[model samples]
Target: MLRQNLQQKLLQKLSPQQIQFIKLLQVPTVALDTRIKEELEENPALEDPSLMTADEPVSEYDDLNERDDYDSEAKEDTSTDEFNVEDYLQDDNTNDYSTSYNNGDDDEEKKETPIAIESTFFESLQEQLDLVPLSDTDFIVGKQIIGSLDDDGYLRRPITSMIDDLAFSQNVIVEEEDVHEMLKVIQSFDPPGIAASDLQECLTLQLKRKDVNNPIIKKAISIVEHHLDEFTRKHYDKLEKSVGLNSEELKEVVAEILRLNPKPGDSNQVTTKQLQIIPDFHISNNDGILILTLNSKNAPELRVSRSYMDMFDHYDKAAQKDKKLKEAVQFVKQKLDSAKWFIDAIKQRQQTLLKTMNAIMHYQYEYFLTADERKMRPMILKDIADKIGMDISTVSRVANSKYVQTEFGTFLLKSFFSEAIQTENGEEVSNKEVKKILEDCIGNEDKRRPLADEKLTEILKERGYNIARRTVAKYREQMNIPVARLRKEL
Candidate 1:
């Protein structure tokens, strides 16, 4: 049964424009160009102002308005369409999209950075595989083995699974012995340890290729082959006893083992890992004053298509208003509305990013003026959100994946925010400062006997900054510093 009741309730929802703004806000400057290009391809009513022809006038709506004035006799019949069309473009260049339509002298040319191309890990292995003369069946097995290797160059797939894949995909059946033989051949390829299934095998493969005649190489091979557990645990005393080598001999063996490539496949990743970081904001220190400017690339020149406006005008004044004409008019209306929403979203995105970065710059003014991180104060998403009169999620969206370039270096916007940790005197400081202190202490420590988290905590206590041992360990781990045992050297 259907039921109806009178009720009062409040519902909150984001409009289409708000949702678009949120998505565009989180996109970093590096990815924004591709996003805008995608929108241009999808929406016929939107066009890049820079792509406009030299002879074409920028705005056609002005002439259309004049044309409507001249057609006073027909204007009465087309009042609804005319009013809607005019209202759609009323905020034309005067309000929204001023970054593209206005902002003279600030506009600059956008240039793309070129990246160098290099061979992939699998491709390099394939070249070596090609040089090894084999039967067509063996060659297919080798290709399948190379294809199974991950980016780290490790073939984690079991032979049975690969055999099934070959049967299903390539319709080539091979025995387990054939696959193992091919794997051994590829493992012997250049940059030794390429196809080893595990780290022990990988290291053993690399060590075997070294000076076998040298006594130290033999001892190193023995340590890896038998006493690998002791070697990895850094139990130097036990390693010396197990391998029957004195301190100097064990040291030499350990040194020989240290030089092996753990991830041999990553050598080919040099070309593929070349990620470009385009900063969203640029902060400069001029005569003791900090100035923050958004990257001009973030402010692309986008506008509604003048041809689309003319087409709407033609459709609106057509004498024959058929079904097809009505459908065309509705389609054009949807496109125009979408274009307007997109342009307005871009404008709001610009304002929001500037406001957010401006607030962050002022809040950390001392840190920006002087590149010392100690000058940075504790700041969180709420701080900026409140200062900018926006939601915390909005501020978070602006900060996420965004970067800023200063004299010191380019840094992620998220780096500036940290939880407040109070000093003994009740003065609040950024956890970044604590992390920096931890990094410095670890950097200048005695590797023979590294400072444990407890000692680090005591040192902080002596300096009038009280924090627990666990907190110190947390900070140490955050900076990728190992514990006392792992940090010790021979």
Candidate 2:
């Protein structure tokens, strides 16, 4: 014999409508229009306000007022409750719903213009290669070498592997010497560093193209060729001893080396078509007060079709009840419900976006007003989420892809959030402030003797910012600034 025990539990889950709103909230303004267009195409019951006439009535089935007869027949046949057509035919006019913003702008005038295309880096190289004078085998080998180059214009593949490729793929047996000759020809192409195999080679190629008679140019080339390791490590003493140059002369050589392009292929790299960023919110500073406005393009005029509403009402009053008529009514009800749910989701998305952004704007109010990044306070997603009474995930979704235009400049919303760091006075400040101070210190330090992380930490402590040497190094790396040794000059 088996016994069963009674157990009860409660569970929470998101409905379809809630999930829909969450997805829409994460979509940026630039892509929201396309999303709405897709919904309009899929749902026949949905319609744009511009497509409907002004004088059109909300419902055509209003004349079919037979509620009393339908009720009495429902009572006689209790099974009719299983298919209650009256529930869907209620007098709710979704036609009155408008998705347009109050600012009044025509929807037909907004459109995206096509962008022009440009030639890629490889295509330009191939065109240049066509003009070179070479025999058929040499031309094929040269083309193979060019194809092996990466986006940075460096030939990362080994010559031995390329030789194998030529023998198997092209049915041509070529020696390492022949490949090297072709590579030399490619290195002499338009871009000074186009076919260099490494950073040292790239820099040497560029420096060789400069005035050969200049002592500084020759010294620079020698430094890149022989003393490259010492130069990179900022071992100025070693470089001066090896190159036989005085302090002032080494400075000139260092300056010349710094001017050469380390990555030559970057100059001819194909440019990508930049996407236009349409800010979702605009914050204007007026008389020291910041006012936020949502972008008008986000709000499009949308409505449920009046004809669909009228057809549902007509089916409800039909004297002859049939299977086909019931199916048709059910289909119309689904479409209508979906249309209403979508409109509601859009409204909810707008509200959530505004609420989250407003909280962030006010939280960083001082920074926005003065355009001083130092004024920004320590803030995180949790801070805004708590203020707006929403989940942290919701706040993150809103901040991740959204852009805002301010009196200062257009910035990504996510850039405003930063982790907190405590000062010597037990006060909390944004890490951005610490980074800004570090940037200034690095910028003003004597290039002859750059400050190391330990010294940087001491300086920061003197200014009331209590941070460790490791943390200072972390922040410096985040800013893409090299270590003191690499930053050292003459």
Candidate 3:
């Protein structure tokens, strides 16, 4: 049955431009340099810096309307006395803009900063691959396997599929044994555990290669290889009975397992090349009060090219207006407009980042100053949006994938924002604070009898938090923590 009913609801949808603006708001100055280069490559009318800033005066568009009528001979005579664009152009200037199109001096000073080398994970892995000696066939197979690895350096593809791919795509009929051999060789590459087919295999491979001597690792490997189901399902008692290990022995094995690097690929990550988060705003202890500074790096100094401005004026003085000249004038204008827009976007990014972070710092002052996660207050995207006078999505973009470095440590921008829960005293508290307390409680609790969410809630209540068991569970999961039973010790 089809039925039509009258319905009225307010709709809030962002336009493409608005979405672009929001995305532009989050990009820092370093990325802006790339964006400028991209724009320059795509838009030819945009003048390069050198041509636009020449010292010699040229006819500009200022007289575009006034000099509409002129005899050809008379105009030619007047042009000799006209400003030569060359006198203004300095030989050292390499700006892409041509002389007639040059805007004044401001654009010259806004040259982009040179980018430094920041080798990524894949690049680093490839460098290691180069040092290993192998036959052409093995090298080819090895690289293909390496390429198939995930960020954690695990072989996500099945051996059978990789074998099939090698045969069909490369037109090389290699045995699965050959592929397996190459796989072993690649696995032996730096970042030891990479290329393993599964978690247990990955861990076992790393542990076997380690220099440490401990009975726990041997037992853990045995348990993982034979009774992985028991380990993963948290069937600790069953593992104890089947493996013939006592409670203390099982605990030691668990600790050893925890000590292993789940993502072995991270071991090779270069600290120097790592991307460090520099906050767009800084909150400092200023004479007993929090003082904020807009990370001035976000605000790039920019100005229009004077030579391009002169070109517009020069084009107007032509005795007989050439169609090419008219088109050139239009082209320069469009580039100027685009350049202006880019400058405006950069400014908007700075303002938006500052506004969003400022609102957050003010909202969570206690958490920032004291370095106590429990001191955090519940804050949703809407809460920040309301405070910063922007849409919720805008606030979300600023918070998403953004980090802030503080006096205590660096934290994800969104980490400070959490939903609220009521305390036993009927007081609203930030869920972040509750999670912190929960973590602290677990950290301090005796492992023999870990506190369940229900008991955790009671503990929180005793400490003045009136939270429910479900809420405690929710916070635990949000913090990526396991349940109390799984967190249990021998």
Candidate No. with top TM-score: 1
Clashing pairs in 1: none
Candidate 2, TM-score vs. the true structure?
Answer: 0.84
> Can you write out model 2's per-residue Cα lDDT over 1-490, one digit (the tens) per residue?
9999999999999999989888899899999989989999999887777655899665554433543445666344533545444433433343333433343355533666665576677888888889999999999998998899998889999999999999999999999999999999998887888788799989999988889899989999999999899888889999889999999999899888888777767776655756789889989889999988788766666766666866865665577879999899889878888887887788778788889889998999899999998999999999999999999999999999999998778999999999999987889999999999999999999987899999999999999999999999999999999998888866
Give all TM-scores, in the order shown: 0.89, 0.84, 0.68
- Each candidate's clash count: 0, 0, 37
| Candidate 3 per-residue C-alpha lDDT over 90-115 given as tens digits, one digit per residue, 9 for 90 to 100 | 23233322232223354543554455
Question: Is candidate 1 or 3 superior in TM-score?
Answer: 1
Please identify which of the two predictions, 2 or 3, would achieve the higher lDDT against the true structure: 2
Q: Each candidate: what lDDT?
A: 0.84, 0.83, 0.70
Question: Where does model 1 exceed 4 Å of error?
Answer: 1-3, 55-62, 65-84, 88-109, 160-179, 270-274, 317-323
Among all windows of ten consecutive residues in candidate 2, which has the lowest summed lDDT? 95-104
Q: Model 3 — which ten-residue stretch has the worst lDDT?
A: 95-104
